[model samples]
Target: MALSQTGIRRWYLVHKWTSLICTAFLLLLCVTGLPLIFHHEIEELTGAHSSIEQVAGGGTASLDTMVEDAKRRAPAQVPGFLFWDSEKPLVAVVTASSLTDQQNIVIHYYDARSGAHVPAPPHDEGVMAFLLDLHKSLLMGLPGTLFLGLIGLIFAVAVVSGVVVYAPFMRKLAFGTVRKDRSPRVRSLDTHNMVGIVTLGWVMVVGLTGLILTMATPIALIWQIDELSEISAPYEGKPPPTRLASLDTAVAAARAAAPGGQKLSSVAWPGTMFSSKHHYMIAFSGETPLTERLIHPAFVDAETGRLTEIRDMPWYVKGLFLSVPLHFGDYGGMPLKIIWALLDIAAIVVLWTGLRLWFGRRRVPIEKRVEELRGGGVPEPAE
Candidate 1:
């Protein structure tokens, strides 16, 4: 059903306000996130990362050496998380929590093939890290995180309202039509509407998924409070195990418990917030394209190295995992990244033109603005 003039006006207000509220944050996201898309490549070019050369025999290195070296490098620190780069499995990053400072953690990288210490990638203080933190939380911690999430929500509203009003505005214009030979206001309006409509689906998906990504903390809390609590119920309130079982043994037990074709993703040691005081929480990823986001957690007894429980991730947890990489547009190969970049640029243009039209309409009467939406007649700028 076609929208009435009153309906169009209502949606126009929705589109305008929502877009205005979130456009600034969205612009920052686009700028910071653009470099993030090519972060890996940038790392290689800047010597932050090195190309991994395969060993002669395709032999796997012992995880024990990597862990031992990591501990040796940070003797005062306790082991926390251990993970390998999916793209460069030959490199392992082991995190060690500081002994004196709870907030500080040391990250050590190792060549999985030879157990040699590799220079860790740029982290908290580096350029990429700065951009990453700004993109993630705007340097404001939880409040910043939640605020960006709100922006994402507003962007979603803007997308919906824009799409709704696009039909009425474009009723008389051809698809992808940009009125170049028109007033500045009309041209800006055409650019805004055209680019917005062209990138509608991509923008909506990215925006909504980005919104979900910002809720990661809450979703993780849910998992910890729900499924994780159930799994660790037997060990609740138990003191930290002083004489813990070997991490290698615990990992092996976890691997045995996990299904075939799943790869270990990361491990959270006992006493960590994400793990029970008496259990080492091990996470694994599926081998297939789709199931990769569905984490299968394996809980192993810290003292006995016994597999306690193995369970599939809940939907929200899966959604968080999926939303993260999807929002970054880094999951797919280079071609997909290029496409994402171009669509991102298109979205920026849409935002710019929208702002132009909005500012241009300040001096014009509201009636003329409504008529402008109904049919493209150039409106003069007030200044």
Candidate 2:
């Protein structure tokens, strides 16, 4: 729908300020996010990732052995979670001084079949990990994550408002036209509009997905307070199990509790935030990419090794899951990753050109700016 001149002017200001506010952060995100799209592939190429040796019988060793190996590796730390690597036949145990301690955690990897320690680089110590931290949270943890989410929200507004104001300007020009004969600033403005519009869908997807990811901490908290509390109601006032059941028995019970096709992905040990005090939380994933992101959880009694219950994640948590694959373009494999990279590069161009135009725009009244949008007044040459 077409907007009036007054509406266009309002939107132009919205676009202008929102862009100015988020362009720097958004640019940082785009730059850092580019490499992250190929995070797995990059890790594999660098030899930082370990390959799993397949056993002749195609049998995976018991989870108990893996946990023992991990404990031996990090004797001082307690096991927090045990998870399988999605792309390889490797299992990892995440250990820390305490379940709640988020710092100095260590990940111990083992060959799923042989149950031998696989020496791989620490997950938190690497260039890609550094870029990922900066991209996701600026190394400030939840606060930085939430801050970037707000920036994403502002970026969405900027994109929408940019489209709103661009409509009036484009009414007279062909779609995707960049006028070289015009002054430098005009040419840049045209290029910026063209590129922004072309990559509009992709930018919105990445931006909104990123915003959702930032809410992970809060979403987990809500789940714990709401659904988890309900799940734990039966065992109210019960202390965490003193002598836990066998890891293998708990895993077996959890597997039986889950559906036919879902495979075990991870297990949160009892007393961890992700698990109940009286139960071991086991998460399962589907075979396909999209399904893998959507987790299905099952609870096993920590002491008895008996199945407690299996349930699907809440809708909001599922939304968070769906956003992961969509945000990274990892679900569709190599082709999608390449396409995502190209769009990211184009977004960088759009941001760069927009910044240039802002810096070069003439000092003019609101009326003059509105006139420029109306495609009547000529913007002054790049200053």
RMSD of each: 2.6, 2.0
TM-score of 1: 0.91
**lDDT string, candidate 1, 153-259, tens digits:** 88889999988888777777788887777667777888888888888888888888989988988887787788777877887677778987887788889988788
Give the alpha carbon lDDT tens digit for every residue of 20-120 in model 2: 99999989999999999999888886542446644343346888888888888889999999888776777888999998777779988877777778888
> Once all C-alphas are superposed, what RMSD does model 2 give against the true structure?
2.0
Under the 3 Å rule for N, CA and C atoms, how many clashes does model 2 have? 0
Q: In each prediction, how many residue pairs overlap at the backbone (N, C-alpha, C within less than 3 A)?
A: 0, 0
lDDT by candidate, in order shown: 0.78, 0.85
TM-score of 2: 0.95
Scanning candidate 1 in windows of ten residues, the lowest lDDT window is: 94-103
**Candidate 1 colliding pairs:** none
In terms of lDDT, model 1 sits at 0.78
